[model samples]
Target: MNLQAVLAINAIGIGIIVFVLSLLRRQRLHIGYGALWIGASVLGMLVVSAPPVFRLVTRVIPTSLPFQAVVVMALSFIFIVLIYFSVQLSALLRRVTDIAQHIGISELEAKSQAPERNPVEVEKRGE
Candidate 1:
């Protein structure tokens, strides 16, 4: 790799690592996701620092270019992560809906059991 490309890649990899660490420190990111981000950044750094790895990958994959292979790998990783998050979101939505239904049912049950009181009787009793 050229000096400029190496420098840029190192910068980006370091930046990603730093950003993920900060998010972890702030409790803004989950540990699982943060670890994945860190791993990706480290992988990027390794790929950029050593061009031979990319060459090996290209040879194995029969890709036209090393960059294309890298792009495909990155995209594939992103797609998998998106699918994982989608499933998690679906589960959370289902739980929330169940909780809401349970709350509604509880309110209805409570109302059914409680005797209705007349406002006029209450007022007269108060007076």
Candidate 2:
């Protein structure tokens, strides 16, 4: 990789790290999400700082170019993150369903315990 490209990558990695840290400080991002961003930024920085390591990775992979290897790695990372978020969403959905069912059951129980009121009697009392 060229010096300019390496510097640009480092700059981007540092920017991401700073942005993640600010979000964490402001409590805008949860720790689990922040950690993933931080890890990605660190990995980017490491790869940018060590061109030889990237070259080695490209050699190990079937990619003809370093850029292709990087792209593949990025896509793989995104896929894994997507799977993680999907699992989290599924759990949240399950919990919400359980809560709604519980509320429905509680409402039924409460209604059964309360005495039924006659509309005619209620209207006469109001008059």
Candidate 3:
């Protein structure tokens, strides 16, 4: 790649890193996810700016076209993020289920322990 192209990629990568840090600072993003973005940006920068690493990646992910490596890399990153989100969602679902069960049990127990009123007297008052 040309120097200009490399510089542009580096600038974009740096911009992404800065944006992710800003999100982290604002509490809009979790540290774990922010780290992922930063890592991706760094990897992208390295792949573009470093020929050796780029060659290695291309060799490992061989494609019919030269630019396919970038496409494959983007797809792989998306797949990883999807898997991470699915795992997080699964864990959260389990936690929510457990919490709901506990709440239901607590409510049941409280109701059982509370004093009971006579249905007949309650109806008479209503009348």
Candidate 4:
């Protein structure tokens, strides 16, 4: 009935969809770390949005603290998830470059191994 409840329920639904789709596709998800992000997002939404849960906490924890803590915690979760993927992306890019370089070097080595084809000797013979 309330806005928060709506949001939380929607978030849970969306998370489940994403998880199912990604898993079914055998998706090589962004650096192989999407599960934690989805889990955190779903759990955080559910915890924050539920009225009864907050009602209980408001008794001991300062009234304002719950809101403040939730905001901070949600932000932290988002930032952490972003950073994890960013690091993974960077690592993947580095590996791609390293592989490319390795392939280039192998190609060069292969070129050099051709029979009867030393550039310097060929030059001298030509003269």
**Over the stretch 53-98, how does candidate 4's per-residue lDDT look in tens digits?**
6555455455455565555666677798789779988999999999
**Which regions of candidate 2 fall more than 4 Å away from where they truly are?**
113-127
Name every residue pair that clashes in candidate 4.
Answer: none
Q: Which candidate leads in lDDT?
A: 3
**CA lDDT for candidate 2:** 0.84
lDDT score, candidate 1: 0.84
Q: lDDT by residue for model 1 over 1-127, one digit each (tens)?
A: 5778778878988999999999999999999999999998898778767878867766766677666776787788889989999999999999999999999889978888655568799888995
| Candidate 1 Cα misplacement greater than 4 A, ranges | 113-127
- Each candidate's lDDT (Cα)? 0.84, 0.84, 0.88, 0.68
**Candidate 2: clashing pairs of residues:** none
Q: TM-score of the candidate numbered 2?
A: 0.79
- Estimated TM-score per prediction? 0.76, 0.79, 0.79, 0.60
Question: Which segments of candidate 4 are over 4 A away from where they belong?
Answer: 1-32, 49-65, 114-127
When sorted by lDDT, best at the front, the candidate numbers are 3, 2, 1, 4
Residue range 12-88, candidate 3, lDDT tens digits: 98999999999999999999999999999999999978898888888989997645886799799989999989999
